[model samples]
Target chain A: MILAVAWRNIWRNKTRSLVILIAICLGLASGIFYMAFYKGMVVQRINTAIKTEASHIQVHHKEYLNNPDKKFVISNTDSTVQIIRSNEHVKAISSRVIINTMAQSAKTGTGVKITGINPEDEKQVTNLSTKLIEGTYFEEVKRNPIVIGEELANKLNVKLKSKVVVTLQDMQGNLTGAAFKVEGIFRTSNTAFDKASVFVRKSDISRIMQLDNQASHEIAILLDNNENLASTNTSLTEELSTLDVKTWREIMPEVSLVESSFGITMFVFIGIILLALLFGIINTMLMAVLERKKELGMLMAVGLNKTRVFTMILLETVMLSLVGGLFGIALGWLLTFYFGYQGIDLGTWSTAYESMGFDTLVYTQLPFYVSMQIALMVIVTGIIAAIYPATKALKLKPAEAIRIDL
Target chain B: MNVIEVKDLKKVYNSTEVKVNALNGIDLTIEKGEFTAIVGPSGSGKTTFLNMLGGLDSPTSGDINIGGTEIGKLSSSKLIDFRLQNIGFVFQAYNLIPVLTALENVEFIMQMQGVDKKQRQQRAKDLLIQVGLGDRINSRPSKLSGGQQQRVAVARALASKPTFVLADEPTANLDSKSTENLLSMMEELNKQEKITFIFSTHDQRVVNKAHRVITLEDGKIISDDRKNE
Candidate 1:
């Protein structure tokens, strides 16, 4: 009966109740939508980084990371590649001859990292062949063919088929220069990476540097299933203790920092929204209780104890909050899924986002756990908001309240 | 048995600058099944006396014994429980919970006592029928007439089978016809069911129907008269 009365009491002031309900609904929807947008952006950037720059995992000479100059190449590339390829989880693997060097055209010169990669393996591992903005990718060239980022090519004032000069130290510690034709111009999502990196055939660069067939600086791996990353890394770590095996998170700690911060930031945003809604709930419930002071007093007079009175008021507030929260979750879910399908395009801001390695189109995704978390948060907020008003309702003395005219 | 006993009951209203005596040095007693009226002029403390009898307010310096229990010695929560079990109250405004139906309002007291649903429902229906509101059991307070709401309030007060009911000007908001109807119905309940009823009112109609009338002047009872007994 008390439950029935509490439920009926909410509709006593239908306009006021509906207004607060709408406010709660809109607040939750906006908060959740913003969180989904940011989560989508973070996920997109991580995916782009994995696909374009770092594969799922990277292997380097144990000392190459500490001293990434010319002398620290991995010595047994074929054996290492063979062992890694035996793992079913390894989708693609490639060995690279990396050198810090300078590329020059007739007009200009700039510092860059020249990466010597096998065309076929690099295509599967990093998919560099698909990012061609102009020209062929290491194909149909008899001489030394190089693939340079569009940013770097523009900086050096070179284009496809333009002869560029590369200066670097050989394996014997002698500064050597070689002339190469730019066979491809690639533009990746990251402008900084595009500006400072170029790629060449590993055989061609290694022969010029007088290095053995086994010499390579880095081995990149792409996994068939991203979920197998930890197990595969642990297995590879045990299999090859001489090499340093690092996941993308370890290779790019800044990305991991951003990913973790996104979760915290999402909760903070929701907390702020819920806090604002908390005040509104408190105000509405306070009015509801105060307006019925006489009725509440009569309830007390008619044998309703303090505990039951308190429970009645609290139940009303909780019911109101849950009703509004469910509607808000449904609305937010609808909006997120609809936009997630169509994609929200940041057309004018693509360049700014691409510079930060984020994709222009954001696809919002709200996990089931996150939705459940929001439901729990809203219920807690309701409970907290009800406390002050319930206490006030319990404080009304039946003697004074019944006789008091208003 | 003496259902109510008051000895030198005193209630003083201490304001910022004045201390007015709302009830002054009153001694009263009433037996079971008595239809009594405490009649007084404005500011004569009739309402105060009723409030104290119903355990609604505490007297400044007095002892009130209701049905063998000293109400003044009980804690606030204990007093509320004692009142719920021992005394019923009917307000001038007929303060029924507006959201609840007439039947639910009558069942409210029994529900608070943790009575089973089947028993409370049948008892509430019989009581509503006794009050001539059986047909209006499902109507909310807002839908009922002023007299009907007051009858519902009476039924609710009697739902707990209290030792005595304290009515403070219950007919103040009713018309002459409704007032006559309510007073006679309450008189019937008093005589037929042996339900003790104590009222504080200035209404001549109520005072004429009461078997005993205690008139107060200046917060002190001046006359205790019994008629038609």
Candidate 2:
């Protein structure tokens, strides 16, 4: 009977219940949608960056990571190759010879980081070969030609077959280099890469830098399973007999730190939204309790007890929250799915995003737990919000309330 | 046996700056199976006295012993339980839970008394029929007439088979003819079921029909009269 009374009383004023429901629904949907979008963006960037910019692990001489210019060769190149070949998960290996050299066109000259690799193996590991736009790929030309970044090509105004001079410091600390024709212009979807990286053949670079019979600076390895990243890196280093190992995260602490901070930021934002909705629900439910004070008193006087009254009010609130939460989950799911499918075109900001190695379109898909979190938040808050109102109703003085007019 | 015994009872409602005495040092006793009426003008402390006797309000200092227990000393929750099991009430406003149907309202008190649904249903139906409301069992308070709603309230008061009932002007909202019908039904129940009834009101028809009458003035009893005796 107490439950019946509470149900009827709630319906007596429909407008108030509706207002509270709308607030809860919107809060729930916004929290779910925003979390999904931000997380999707992070995942997308990581996937693209891992696929195109860096491999699972890189093996280099300890000095290669720090000094970067030290061409001091490691011993047992064949033994290191044996270690790499022994791991079947090590799908591909692109040996790189990196040098900081000045490139000169007839009209311009600029400093560039040149990376030389085997054309077939490099393509198997990175997306660079597929990005060739205005010129022939590295596989097409055999004159030991250079593949320039799109931005570098623009700055130098040298298309395919254009003559450009390259200079580098030799073993004697003297500048030793040679001129080569421009084989291709490639853009890595990352402006930083397009402005800086210059690809050449490993043999050609060894001949230029006078390191015959020696492995290049680093061996960038791709693995079939990504979960082996840190472990493979360690094992590879242990087996290399002469080199150090590094995962991309270890080599780039700033990126990992940024990712961690973004997580904290998302948690904080969700906390505020949840707290606000919880209080809103409580305030609204308490007002309902107060307004029905006399009615509750009448029910008590008619023989209803505190426990029954408390249970009744709690049932109403929980039911309302479930309805509102389920609706919000459906709505939020739709909003996220629509955006994930069509994606947002950032054409105006494409260059800026590409500078960071992101595609022109941003697609966001929510994880399963994000929706669960939203549902869990609503349910927890709903139950918590009911406490005050139920307590007040249960504590109502039957005599005082029974005597109340109107 | 006396169903209600009030010995030197008092009640004080304390506010921020003043205390209002609703019931002041009074003594009264009412027997079982009696249709008694408490008569007074407005604000003469009749409602306060009734509330105390029904265990709805605590005495400032004294005893309200009903069914061998001094209700004034019992805890709040115990008092509520005692009231549900032992005393039924019919308020002046008809106080039927407006949301419930006539039958549901009647069954509510029985439910609180921990009666099973089947028994409660049967008892509620019989009481409603006794109150001449068999046809209006499913009607909500708003859908029923003032007399019919009062009938429902009366049915609810009797649903628990209490030792006694307190009716605080149960006919205040009824028409003159309907008031007569309601009083007759109460008198019939008092005689046939041996259910004790104490009505606190100023209505002449109620006062005359009751078997025992008590008049109050300024929170003190002025007269107590018996008709059949």
Candidate 3:
């Protein structure tokens, strides 16, 4: 009976109840959509970093940490690659001969880390071929083929098939210069990373650096299962004691920092939205209690105990909040799912997003746990919001309340 | 058997600016099956006395003993339980819960008593029928006439099978015909069920029909009259 009364009481002022419902629904939708957008942007950053640069795990010569010169080339690169390929979880592995050099075009010169890689191996590990924006990716380019980022190409004012001079120190610490023709121009989500690196053939760099056949400075591995990242890196480190192995998270701590900080940012955003809605709910319920003071008083006079009275008011408040919350969650899910498929294009803010290491095209992805957490948050907010109004209703003295006019 | 006893009942409305004595040292007793009217002019303490008697308000210093228990000594929650079990109240405003039908309003008190739904339904229906509102049991208070709504309030009060009924100006808003009909029905119930009916009113029609009349002036009983059959 109390539940029945509480349910009917909400419809007493149909317009007011409807307005509250709409407010809660819209508030939740906007809040959840914003959270999904943030999550999408974060996920995009992590995927870009892993696919275009880090490749899950990297192994370097132990001496490279102290002296990253040409002298620190891996002593047994071929055997290491063979061992890595034997593991089922090891999806792909690429060896690289890395050299820091200054590249100069007709227009300008800038510092760059030139990576020498086996084109087929690099293709499997990083999918470097797919990022090609212009020309080909080392396809039948016989001599001195190089791939540069679009931003770097623009910075140096160079185009496809353009000749550029790269100056580096050889094994004997003597300045060595080589001219290279650009075979590919690629662009990635991170403009800073794209502008700082270039790729070339490992055989060409090994001959020029005067290192042994199949010798390289770095080994980048892409795993079949990312969830095995920690165990795989640990196993590789223990098995190959002479080299240093690091996961993507360990190799680039900034990406991990951004990932963890986003969780807190999501909670803060949700809290602010729910707090604003809380006061509106409390105010509406308070008014309802005051408006029905006489009726409530008569209920007490007719033998409805204080506890029952309090529970009824609380039940009404929770019903109102949950109704709105459930609708809002449904609305938020619809929008998120639809946009997750179609993707939200922030093309107008592409430059800003790229600068911040995020992709412009965000696919709103909310995990099931996040959705459940949001529902729990709304229910808790509802229960918390009901406390004030329920207490006020409990404080009314039935003796005097029954006599109060209007 | 005496159903209610009041001893030196006093009620003072105290505030920072003034202290008004609403009820001043009143003493009274009501026997079983008595239809009594506590009549007074405005500000004569009739409503205050009725409120104290029903355990709705505590007296400043008095003992209100109903069914051999002093309600003034009960806790707030205990007093409410006591009222539910022993006393019924009919208000002047015909305070039937507006959200409920006449049947629901009548069933509410018995529901609060934790009576079985089947028994509560039958008892509520029979009470509404007794009050001549059986046909309008499905109607909400807003859909009923002033007299019909009040009759529903009366049925609601009696739903718990209380020992007594306290009606405060129950007919103050009724027409002459409705007032006469209400009084006749209440008198018949008072005799048939052997239930005590106490009311505070200025209506002469109610005072005339009551078996006993206690008149108050300035918070004191000025006349206590009983009608002989």
Candidate 4:
């Protein structure tokens, strides 16, 4: 009966109740949608980091990462590649001869990290070949073909088929330079990576530096699925014990941090939104309790106990909150579904977003469990908001309240 | 048999600078099945006496024994239970829960007493019918007239089957016809069911209908008149 009465009481002032309900609804919907948006952006960045920048895992000469000197090379790279290819989870692997050098164009010069890779092998490990905005991937030029980033091309004042000179130190620590024609200009989301890195044929760089073709400074591996990353990384670490093997997470800790701390960030964001809505609920319930002081007094005088009175008020607040919360969740879910499929284009701010390695077009993503958790949070907020008003109702003296005239 | 016995009932209101005695040294007893009225002017403590008798307020120094149990000695919670079990109240404003229908308003007290659903529902229906509100059972208080709302209040007060009903100017807001109808209905219930009724009223209509009248002046009972005796 108390439950019935509590439910009816909410509609006593339909306008008042709906005002608070809408406040709660819109508040939660915005919070949930914002959370989904941010999660989508972060997930996209991590995906880009793995697929386009750093493959699932990488192996290097134990000291090559700490000191990028050409002397620190993984000897017998052909045998290492063969051993890695034996793993069922390994989708593709590529060996790279890396050197920190300068690329001088006809107009200007800039520092760059030149990566020498077998075009076919590198194509399987990274999606750079697919990101070509200009020429073919090492097809047009017969010798010393290079694929440079759009940002690097802009900075070096060079275009497709432009001859650029790469200055570097050889394996014997002697100054060496070579001319390579830009075969392709690729543009990735990460502007910084695009500006600083360039790729060329591994044989051409090895022949020029008088280095052995069987030695490599870095070995990149791509897995069929991210779920196999840990297992494949561990297996490769054990098999290639003499080399330094690391996953993408260990390679890019900043991106890993964004992925790992997303839950806490969302929780805090939603918490603030709920906290603001808490006061609105409290005020609405307080008005309801105060307005019915005389009626409540009559109930007490007629034998309704304090516990039942408190329970009635609590139930009213919770029911109100739950109704609005469910609607908000439904609305948020609908919005997420629509945008997740069609994607939200942040084209206006694409430059800022792309500079930080985030795709401008983001597809909202929120797991089912996250929406469930938000529902639970709404219930908890209702309970907390009910306490003060319910307690105030409990403090009314039946003798005085009954005669309060209003 | 005496249903309520009061010995030297005294209630003093102590404020920061004043000590106004609301009830001063009253002694009285109400018999079973009696229709009595406690009448007085404003601030004469008639409401205070009724509040104390209903166990809604505590006395400064007194003993109020209702049906062999001393109400003053009960704790706040136990006093509430005691009121639920032994007393009924009807206020002037017809303070029914506006959200509930007339029938639900009547059944609410019985529900609070943990009465089973079917039994309480049936009794609530019977009580509403007895109050001449059988047709308005499904009407909320806001939809009913002032007199009809008071009738619902009376039905609710009687649903508990309390030892006695305390009515504080129940007809104060009613028209002459409604007042007469309500007083006659109460007289009939008192005569038929032998249910005791104690009222604090300023209306002469209620005073004329009572079998006994107790008048107060300056927080003291100045006259106790019995009509039939």
Candidate 5:
């Protein structure tokens, strides 16, 4: 019966009840949505860098660490790749050869850093073939050609089928050169990479760089799970004595740091909302006690123990908080899921977002556990706010309480 | 035997500037099942007297023995238990909880007293009916009149079947007609249930109708008198 009375008391004043409820709801929504988006974006950042750029690990010549420009210095990359492919945990591998050169066009000239790769094997490690914009991949024509970055292509004033001379020094300090047609154009996630980098056939690199008997300077390794990247990198480092193995984080420190910073920022954001809601709920309960001072005092006079009065007020607070929190969680979850599905692309926000190193389309996705845990946190926060108000109500003097007119 | 005994009852509130003695050693006694009234002007310690007897307030220096227990010396929690089991109170403002219905309000004290479900419902229903509020069982305090609300409070006071009802100017907010009706109902309950009714009031009509009247002024009793039945 006391519980019934307590429940009824909370709803007697509609406006007060609503004010408290909205406070709790807003708090829960802000916390839940921020957590969901922050967690999702962090995972997305790691995966994108791992699968589309760094791969799980990259194996480079021990000499490459000191001077990566060393040519014709590969130590049978094919046998090493075969050894890695035999491992069940290994996902894919691509051999990469890069040469710093200058390209001259009819209208313009610019310095270019060209990466030589086997299109078939490269797709396995980096999935870059799909990033091609104009013309087909060079593999489709069975011809050795160069794929230029957007910035390089713009500077050279070249389009599909444009021709350019790639000039550079080969091994043994020999000056050598190559000519190739532009077969395709591609964009990198970060525009800096697109501005300076170019792609070429791996066989052509061996022929021009005078390494016909060797492969590229490094090999990129990928795994189905980016979570395993660090462990795999460790294992490879232990097994390979002549080469250095680097994980995605070590290869891309700046990007990984952003992920960590984003995570901490999210936690702080939610903490502020949670703290405000807790106090809001506590304030509402205190107001309730003040408003009903006379009645509470009378209850004591009529043989109600102090414990019962305290319990009634606490229960009232919990009911108000939890119900409000649930409503807010629903709204936040709906919004999170809707945005997660269709994703708010940064396309229109391109100029601004590009500076932040993200693509035009920024997709959003959240882990199921993240959203569920946030809802549970809402309930806990509500319970915490119930304490002080209950204690104050219990300490009321029965005589003075009954004396109050209202 | 007297159901209540008060001797040399004194309470002093020591503030920063001075001590305000609310009660200056009141001496009184009431026999079992008696209907008594304590009358006093404002600031004359009528409320202090009631609080001391109900175990809701402690006397600074006094002896209050009610039903064989020295209530004035009990701890706050023990006093609460004692009040729940032995004393019922009615306040000047009716003090009906606005959110509870008449039935729920009446059932509240019984719940605190640890009465079982069926017993609480049956006893509350009986008391509300005795107070002539049977039809308004589902009505909250806001939906009831001053007299009706006071009657519900009275029913709540009696729910635990306490040995006595301590009413502190319970009719202060009621209309004359409602006050008359309330006093008559309380009188009927006192006669039928043989439970004591102790009221502190300044209303002349209330004291005139009482079987015993204790009048006070300036924290001291001026007269203690009883009337023939």
Candidate 6:
């Protein structure tokens, strides 16, 4: 009966109830959609970090990362690669001869880090082959074929089939120069990575620098699934204690920070929205309680206890909030679904977004648990908002309330 | 047997600068199966005295023993339970829960008593029938007229099977015909069911129908008349 009374009581002032209901609905809907949008952007950035920039894990000579000197190469790379390949989680691995050098085009010259890789092995480790804006992946140009980024190509004033001279100091402290024709121009989301990096055939660079073909500076590994990244990284780290083995998270801490701090950011964002809606709910419920002052007094006079009275008010407020919350969740889900499928194109700001390693076209994504958490938060907010008004209702003196003119 | 016993019942309102005596040294007793009226002009303490009798308010100095229980000694929570079990009230404005149907309004009191649903429903229906609101049981209070709403209030008051019903100006908003109808119904219920009724009113019609009439002035009982005596 109390439940029934509370349910019916909310409809007493339809306009007032609906005003607050709509306020909660719109507030939570926007909050939920914004959460989904941010999650999508972060997930995309993480995916790009792993697939394009850093494979699930990377292995390098202990001092090669600290000092990218060509002399700090990992010896006996074949035996180390064989040991890592035996791990069940290992999907693909590519050894690279990393050389920080200068490349000179006919029009200009700029500093560049040349990644020397086996084309076939690199295909499985990185998605650079698929990111080609023009030309083939080390296929069309047969002699000293190189892949450069669109940003780097623009900087060098080079186009497909353009011959660029790479100048570098070899392992013997001698200046070496080689001519390479651009076989591919790839454009990744990270403009900085695009501008500073170029890839060449590992055999070509190793032979030119008089280095042993079996020795390389870095080994990049891609796992079958990122969930296996930790176990595989630990296994490889223990097996190859002589080399530095680091997962993508350790390799890119900024991206890792964004992924880990997403929950707190969401909490603060939705908290602000619910905090605003909380006062609106309180004001509405207080008015409802005040409007029904005489009725409440009569209820007490007729032997309705204070706890029951308080519960009735609480129930009314919760029902109102839950109804609005459910609607908000539904609306938010619908918008997320629509935008997630079609994608929200930030084409106008694509340059800025891409410069920061974010895809311009984002597909909104939220885990099922996140929506459940938001629903729970809404219920908690409703309970908190009900407190003051319900307490006020409990304070009404039955004798005086019954006699109240209104 | 007496259902309510009072001794030196007094109520004082303490303001910033004045202490106004609402109920001054009053004494009264009401027996079972009696229909009584407490009448007075405004500020004569008729409402305050009724409030004390109903356990809705505490007297500054008094012993109100209703059915072997000293109400003033009970905690606020226990006092509410005492009222639920022993007293029923019908306000002057016919304060039915506006959202509930007439049947629900009547059943609500029994619900508070934790009565079985089927039994309460049947009793609510029967009570509404007795109060001449049988056909309008499904109508909410707003849909009912002032007189009809009052009838529902009376049915609601009787639904708890309380020791006595306290009516504070129950007929003050009713027309003559509705007043006469309501009085006739109360008179029949008092005679037939032995349900005690205590009313605080300025209505002469109610005073004329009561078996006993107690009038107050300046917070003191000025007259006590009994037609049966």
Model 3: residue A35 alpha-carbon error in angstroms: 1.3
For each candidate, the alpha-carbon lDDT, in order, equals 0.89, 0.80, 0.88, 0.92, 0.78, 0.91
Candidate 1 on A1-406: residue-level lDDT in tens?
Answer: 8898889988999999999999999999888888888888888778877888889999998888888977887899999999999998999999999988888999999999989999999999886899999999888777999999988988999988999999887889888889999999998778888999999999989988988889899999999977898999999998989999999989988887888797679788888999999999999999998888888887787667898998898889988988888888888888889878988999799789878877788998777788898888999998999999999988898877787676
Q: Which tens-of-lDDT digit does each residue in A196-243 have in candidate 2?
A: 778888788878777754667777778887778767777777776467
Global Cα lDDT for candidate 1: 0.89
Comparing 1 and 2 on TM-score, the stronger one? 1
After superposition, which runs of candidate 3 have C-alpha atoms over 4 Å from their true positions? A62-70, A82-88, A234-242, B16-18
If ranked by DockQ, best first, what sequence of candidates would result? 6, 4, 3, 1, 5, 2
Q: Residues A1-406, candidate 3: write the lDDT tens digits.
A: 9898888888888888889889999999988888888888888888888888899999998878568777777878989998887777899999999988899998899999899999999999996799899999999578999999999999999999998789887777777888889999999888887898999899887777766776788999999877899888888888888888888998879988888787688778888988999999998899999999888888888788989998888888888888888898888888899999999999999998898778999999777687677778887887898899989988888878878887
Instruction: Please tell me how candidate 2 rates in CAPRI terms.
Output: acceptable
Model 2 segments more than 4 A misplaced: A1-9, A72-92, A170-174, A212-214, A223-243, A300-322, A355-360, A383-396, B14-20, B92-163, B176-192
CA error at residue A247 for candidate 3, angstroms: 2.4
TM-score of each: 0.92, 0.86, 0.93, 0.92, 0.89, 0.96
The sequence of per-residue lDDT tens digits that candidate 5 reaches over residues A82-200 is 77777667888898887777887778778887788888888888856787888767755455588877767887999888887878887767887777888888876667667777888
Interface RMSD of 1: 1.4
Off by over 4 Å in 5: A1-7, A23-44, A63-66, A71-74, A140-142, A212-214, A234-242, A275-283, A300-315, A368-395, B16-19, B115-119
**What TM-score does chain A of each model score against the native chain A?**
0.95, 0.88, 0.94, 0.94, 0.89, 0.97
TM-score of chain B of 1: 0.97
Q: What would the per-residue lDDT of candidate 2 be over residues B1-229, giving only the tens digit for each residue?
A: 8888889888887865788877778898888898999998887888888888888888889898998999988888787788888888888773777778999988888777788999889989988888998988999999998888888888888888888988988887788999999999888888888899999888999998999999887788889999974
- Shares of reference contacts reproduced by the candidates, in order, are 0.69, 0.40, 0.73, 0.78, 0.67, 0.78
Q: What is the TM-score of chain A in candidate 6?
A: 0.97
The local lDDT score (0 to 100) that residue A362 gets in candidate 2 is: 68
Predictions: Cα RMSD each? 2.6, 3.8, 2.5, 2.6, 3.2, 1.7
**Cα error, candidate 6, residue A117 (Å):** 1.8
Relative to the real complex, the DockQ score for model 4 comes to: 0.69
Per-residue lDDT of candidate 6, residues A82-170 (tens digit): 99899999999999998888999999999998999999999999899999999999887778999999999999999999999999877
